[model samples]
Target: MKRDERSIRVLLIEDNPGDALLVEEYLEEYILRPDLKHVERFQKAKPLITDGNENYDIILLDLTLPDISKEQLIENIKHLAVEYPVVILTGYSDLEFAVKSLSMGVSDYLVKDTISSLVLYKSVLYSIERHRFIRSLRESEKRYMDLFQLSPAPMWVYDPETNAILDVNEAAINHYGYSKEEFLGMTQSALCVKDSNEDAAEKIEALGSASDRTIQSHRKKNGTIINVEIINNYIYFKACKRVIVLATDVTEKLAHLEAIELQNKQLREIAWMQSHVVRAPVSRLMGIIDLMKTGELDMAEKEQMLDFIFSSAEELDEIIRDISAKSEEAFSDLNKEK
Candidate 1:
């Protein structure tokens, strides 16, 4: 016969053989198959639990065993089977203790003498399903925690009302140079540079109406300013309103862009000087040469005119050299700092 994947695996800790056989018969009556392991005393059950090889769905305790009985039995079972839902099966039920046991995390309190097959089956099924749901929820929370802590980028969660930081991931601690304890005590405003938090807060609040992504400046723990692209969202967590923040460090990217723009500006200035300032000297030299070619000056005057022409030519050469130096400086200074 093919085994059912949904088959319930149950551990029954009962000292009475008759009661143990009865519980098995009750399980057989149910629609679902239950793999039941019966132990007559707590000692035998202890090793099965401690071995860690066996994974039981639910535990049924008689609350009275030869080696361990009554309150001690409940405590011992709970200590050993932390993940399993514990159902107390006692021949005598004390109403006060039953209520208290349930409050202490016991799944069900059953009176063995009056327990019918249907009631026993239902209780086991219900407790197993409820226990599984709670376990699944814990697993979901762990998955989210792993994603946050193991992320390559910084992330944090904070109280939306007080702006107090609630939790920070490992990535956030490493990137921000702050310990986890220090981060928890600090408020979100501490991270932002003065006057920058306002616009970011407003955008974060707008996330409730619609999503917004913003780039803002923030100061690190060591007072180094950084540019970050922030994306935030409002979430209801643990019965409190909170915001989850994700940031990407873009300080280097912005600096690189600014350098490119500066280089372009310097190049434009050089171009203008080459076209305008150099023309003035060249025009003077042309006019002086024209006078000499027309024989407008005597030999001694021509020597004086040659001096003027030489001066203009030198001025033009200086202008071209300055432009060359400026172009070189612009290119050299643009080396990316990051």
Candidate 2:
């Protein structure tokens, strides 16, 4: 009945009725009134704790039990306790075993003789709180790893001080043609076509968390060059100051822009030919017509002007043909590009 409606649930694995009753009294006297479950041995406790559905706060495990005890007992229960903190209950003389169990993943050890109601209560609450914090930290780390390692774009972390590669994502391995081990052993310069900024280290120090991005050329393993825009962000990870880099390849995009520019230049040249060369002969023809209208030339001069007009017309026709030819060529080139 006490296990049905308490906040801090605990599992007590001890065969001694005296010790089990003492722990139960200590836990119940606390303001929280922790719900306690008592099991005689590790064998019966396995199903109650390891079902994944039961959410016990902590375990009070005695070193001596009927079915399981001591180091092997801790190991057996640890494999079942996904996140529940196990506090070992031992005699004062078993301090060495208690210390070893602490290193083996037990939360904390309590000596049975000295542990009063208040002391036992405090140890249970503290162990639960500490274990909660530990589990939360590990979950945060796993989430960060998932986001970085599973991304589709190439990304890596490098130490700004030494320019050494710290870690790389799966995308980086496939994109750069380097294995994970090889990338870790290399520096940023290995993939760079140019040593762009010798003062990047100083800049990263000055910028701190507010890192900027820049475009540069990078060399691949097969000796091919690619244009990339690299972004930088600083983070303190694993006791090192590192910069997280994201490289986006822009070589094909740049090539497409260059092609568009060349097409624009060709169109400008055609426009110039139309306005300058094609208009030159038309201007001469207009001037000869004006002379004829003003009657400025007699019969012989008018014949000479007529001959000049014919030559101008012939030149204009040639200029029109040239413009048409160039226009056709430009269109053909554009079609090919498409």
Candidate 3:
């Protein structure tokens, strides 16, 4: 039958010719065709094992070799286990040793007397796939650690039960003005400002299973308080459930917003002066001029009306100066921020 999988390359390290032939025949009888390289001595396999010229999916190692001692034989197999999955091919007499080899990193062991084509094929496929999976898991974890350590924003991992900080990144160390050792010895509550601690806890508790994000006041090592937006997610770290946090400082952002609001309030005051206060004096001055133009008053009444007009003019000048001062105050505050 045509095999559905790719051909598996195997290296057989055995001194006995018959045992090597039997293993090859067992694989040939199965539907999975494999490429097998056989060597009779440990010295002959050293070059292939060390040099990267040949890449094999798995190794079928003999429990005994002619040139190497039993202790040295296990040492060699341990080294090979790092590169490829290893299966022990042993006689009945070495069954105990073969079982012990499994603990020394051997993938699987099979007795020469009871081996079948199907069993051999399945062991090869299973060992190779399992090794690939384990290697992939290790690579993924390395990538995650790389990102965590190299992140630009403040990041940390903490245990939720005791609120103890587990791990902290370089950015967090610099931002909080704390050493890594110091951070690890402290709890998350120590970083929070006293006033916000209870409110932050209530918001985190209310989030349930979802990620928690809220703006909070955090105290630094130098007793400087800053506002930060903290976002945390639940994750499994080193087989224990933990929370990972990312904090973004929003202190300057909030200050800028407040300044803009104050400037807006000042501008609103100037607009009120223009619309109501300045208009009142100007309207009075125009009414006094209209009464004088009507010629319905005596000389003394006219003089009194002129005095009222002069008073209204002075009020208008004072209102104009007040509005100009408010406008200057608003722009001056804005310029100082820049």
lDDT of 1 by residue, 154-194 (tens): 99999978989998998888888999999999998888774
> Per-residue lDDT tens digits of candidate 2, residues 291-333?
7899968889989998999999999889888878887887777
lDDT of each: 0.80, 0.80, 0.85
Count of backbone collisions in candidate 3: 0
What are the runs in model 3 whose C-alpha is more than 4 Å off? Answer: 1-5, 39-53, 63-83, 90-106, 194-212
Q: Per-residue alpha-carbon lDDT of model 3 for 1-338, expressed as tens digits?
A: 65636788999998889888988888887645678899998899889988999999998888888899888989888888878899988899999999999888889998988989889988988999987887788799989998999899999999999999999999999999999999999999888875244444444445462344577788899989988877889999879999999888867766666678899899888888889998897888888888878877998998898888888889988888888888888999988887
Pitting candidate 2 against candidate 3, the one with the higher lDDT is: 3
CA RMSD of each candidate after superposition: 5.2, 5.4, 4.6
Instruction: For model 1, name the residue pairs that clash.
Output: none
Query: Which pairs clash in model 2?
Result: none
Comparing 1 with 2 on TM-score, the higher-scoring candidate is: 2
**Positional deviation of residue 241's Cα in model 1 after best superposition, in angstroms:** 0.4
